[model samples]
Target: MKEKLLTKEDLAEDHKKAVRGNTKTTREDWLAEAQRVLIEEGVDRVKVDRLANKLNVTRGGFYWFFKNRQDLLDILLANWKDSKNDPLTHTLKGKNKTPLDPLVRFIFTTIRERSYSPALDSAMRDWARTSNKTRRAVDLVDNRRISVLAKVYQGLGYEEEEAFIRARIQYFHQVGYYAMGVHESHEQRLHYLPIYFKQLTGFDLPKEALQGFMEE
Candidate 1:
C-alpha cells in the first residue's frame, strides 16, 4: 500500500493533540502571552481561548495556573503595579549616584532600552476607560511614578511644590508623547535630548551626561 498523505485537517488535529498533551506551560507563559495580546490588540481580545491558540497549548493548561480569565486579568494588573519590576523604580534605587543619574537613567531606559513600554502603558490606559478597577490601578501607578520623578527634582534642590509640578510636566510629557503616537527616530529624539532636559529640568544637560549613551 502507498503511504498515506496527511490532509490539512489531519495536520491540524495532530497539532491540537500535541498541544493538549503538553504539560510544560507555566503561569508566566500564559501571562506573557496575555500581555502581548493586551498590547497588540486590546484587553477585550485577551480571552483564554484566544491566548491558548496563540500559545499553541490547550485551554486546560491555563486553568492549571489560573482560577479563571478574571484571575489572569487581575494578576496582569497586579504585575503592572509591582514597583520591584518597574524600570523607573529600579533606576531611582541606584546607590552613590549623581543627583542627575536617576533622571538620566530614566530617559535612557524609556528611550533607549524601552524598558518602560509605551505600547503597554497606552493599552493599560485604554483598558482603564472601560474598567473602574483598572482606572484606579492606573492612577495609583501614575501617582507613584510621578512621585518618584518628583524626588529626582527634589534631589536637584527644587522645593517640594516646584518639584511636584516639574515632575508632572516631565512625566506627563513622556506619557503624552506615546499617547499622541508621535513618530520620531531614535537619533532624532537623541538630538533633542539636551533641549528637552533643559526645558524640563531648567538646566543644560552636561556633556558627560551623554557619555555612555553617545558611544552606543
Candidate 2:
C-alpha cells in the first residue's frame, strides 16, 4: 500500500461531521445576536469576538456575513429604522373605516402587542450620545414617526399646528414612559388606556376598543 485517496462519499461524510461540530450560522443570526448584545451589554461590548463567543460560533463566521463590525452596526441601524418601525407606520397608514380605527390599532400595536422594543430604543439612544451617525439616524427615525403620527391626527380633523403638537405630546409621553423606567403592570396600563387615549387623541376609547384590548 503506497497511498490512499478519499472518495466523494468520504468527503461528504467529513463535511457532515464538520457541520455537526460547527453549524453554519446565517447572516440574520449574526445580526440578531449583535442586536441582542447591543441591547443587553451596550454598543461597546458588541464586538465581533464577544458576539462570536455569545453565538457559540467562530469569529470567521461573522466576517463571512459582515465586512467588519462597523458594517454590522450600520446594518443594525438600518434594520431598526426600516423594519422595527414598520408596525407604527403601517398602523397609521392603514385605511380603516374610521379615523379612530387607526388610532385604536396604533394603541394596540404599541401597548398590547409591543411591536416596538423599549430596550432597543434606549440602547440606540445611548449609542447616539457618542456617534454622530447614530444620532442622525435616530433623529431621522423620530421625525419620520412623528410626521406620520401628525398625519393621522390631521386625518382626524386637527389643524396643522395642533396635530403636530398632539403628535409630539403622544410620542414624547411614550418615550418618557420608557426612559423614566415607570413600572406598570399590564392591567394597570390597560386600566389607564382609556384616560391616555382621551388625553392624547382627544377621543374617547370606544367601548369596542376597550373590549378588544381586554379580550386580547
Candidate 2 lDDT over 1-216, as tens digits, reads: 221344556545543443224566678888988899999989998887777677676565565566678899999999888834567777878778788888888878778547767788899999999999999988988888899899889999999999999999998997898899899999999989999999999999899878967896
The TM-score of predicted model 1 comes to 0.88
Best by lDDT: 1
Listed in order, each prediction's TM-score against the native is 0.88, 0.87
Instruction: Note each model's CA RMSD in angstroms.
Output: 7.6, 7.3
Stretches > 4 Å off in candidate 2: 1-22, 83-85
Per residue, candidate 1 scores C-alpha lDDT tens digits across 1-216 of 222345556545644453534456678889999999999999999998789788887566666677778899999999997887677778766773578888887877788756777788899999999999999999998999999889889989999999999999999998999899899998899899999999998887778878778887
Model 2 residue 4 lDDT score: 34
